[model samples]
Target: MSKTTRATQALQQAGVPFTVHAYAYDPNAERIGLQAAEAMGVDPGGVLKTLMVLVDGKPACVVLPSDREVNLKKLAAALGGKTAQMMKPADAERITGYHVGGISPFGQKKRVPTLVEQSAFAHEEVFMNGGQRGLQVKLRPADAVSALGAQVAELI
Candidate 1:
């Protein structure tokens, strides 16, 4: 597959330095993020997963470590909303204009409130989906946050 994607294009347009890494994507894998980490021979904590969610019935994007899970109540509070839930897969795909495993916060079809787990900044570099299956981008945490205009919070 071509390494170029909307996500990559967005990053480039923003002038954020990043490196793309391609790996074998297993659609059947139990956990897509972990699979990417293992395929790239990196720590799961350094591989972030992009998730679409509904906070107070509004679309939002969240990026967190592969080894962690989002606490709905915490996420809700972080977003200053009363409730939060995982967006339906079909809804997520429709709103983001990318498949579940390929969604990236940078280049979604719609701009929404986005958050990156504060802890992720602990890592010098992190990997996230590159708007395509089997593709990921490695970049500085601060760069990703700035590129997406995402708030850093305790999302996990």
Candidate 2:
């Protein structure tokens, strides 16, 4: 796709090699993560979802596989924080500068600590939001880790 978004721009500027993937967005679909995986015909395990979580009231980004859930206790322990809670949709958007459904851990209005699930690196490449609904970016797991300053953790 020729369309550009903050996430794409960030990746480009950082010289991170990536491929863009786009699919029809279903506004009414209840499970967007599953829908995207189905639309792309890719393994759900290779699709990463960006989640904004608060670690002691400070926003942090957690990147994990679409097929898994973030273990709050594990995440908190990994971050060395006493508490962790998901950011409200509005708060996530406001903080990440992307809509809730399109948040990418790669680019944001501000930088926050990022933790990527350790298992995600098992995939050669992972697909994630491209800063907009219906758009996804495919990139090497290591490149994502390096470019985003993310630490691999047992978030799942």
Candidate 3:
């Protein structure tokens, strides 16, 4: 069998329902989540951004509200680690098998720990990068946690 892209293969195997939204890609963009929200005409707050962080020397995924920044102190406390810091871009790409702007919490090269902001659980559905830039996947936050085996925590 041939391997499919991370977004498609992971969602299909997990049986998680999701909708894909595609938009024009911009290479010079800074905040990918904001750009995606604007392109999709959705509130930026409803879109989530996936970040790679090193917790106790291990890479982990941290999902947070697009409108808010990750609180490293809180994330450290949640993970029971003394400190947490953003991973290097190259390291993130190598571990996630996706570029910086396209990293998703769903499928990764390695099954690193994942933590999502508790606030996201309040929304009925949320949008996140679909393992690629200019593409997003819409699904329930609960399903995301289930599919990724992520823990719910106050990451932002």
Among these predictions, the greatest lDDT belongs to: 1
Model 3, residue 109: C-alpha shift (Å)? 0.6
The residue-by-residue lDDT of candidate 3 on 1-156, one tens digit each, is 112459657988999998887777577878888888888898888899999999878788999888889999899888889899999999999999998888888778888889999999778999988888788888999999899888999877
- After superposition, the stretches of candidate 3 with alpha carbons farther than 4 Å from their true spots are 1-4
TM-score top scorer: 1
Question: Lowest-lDDT window of 10 residues in candidate 1?
Answer: 100-109
Higher-TM-score candidate among 1 and 3?
1
Residue 76 CA displacement from its true place in model 2, Å: 0.7
lDDT (Cα, tens digit) per residue for candidate 2, span 23-112: 987777776777789889999999998999999888899999998999998998898998999999999999888876788887799999
Q: Which ten residues in a row have the lowest lDDT in candidate 2?
A: 25-34
For each candidate in turn, the TM-score is: 0.99, 0.96, 0.94
Q: List the candidates ranked by TM-score, beginning with the highest.
A: 1, 2, 3
Candidate 1 vs candidate 2: which has greater lDDT?
Answer: 1
Q: What local lDDT does model 1 show for residue 153?
A: 93
Estimate every model's Cα lDDT from 0 to 1.
0.95, 0.90, 0.86
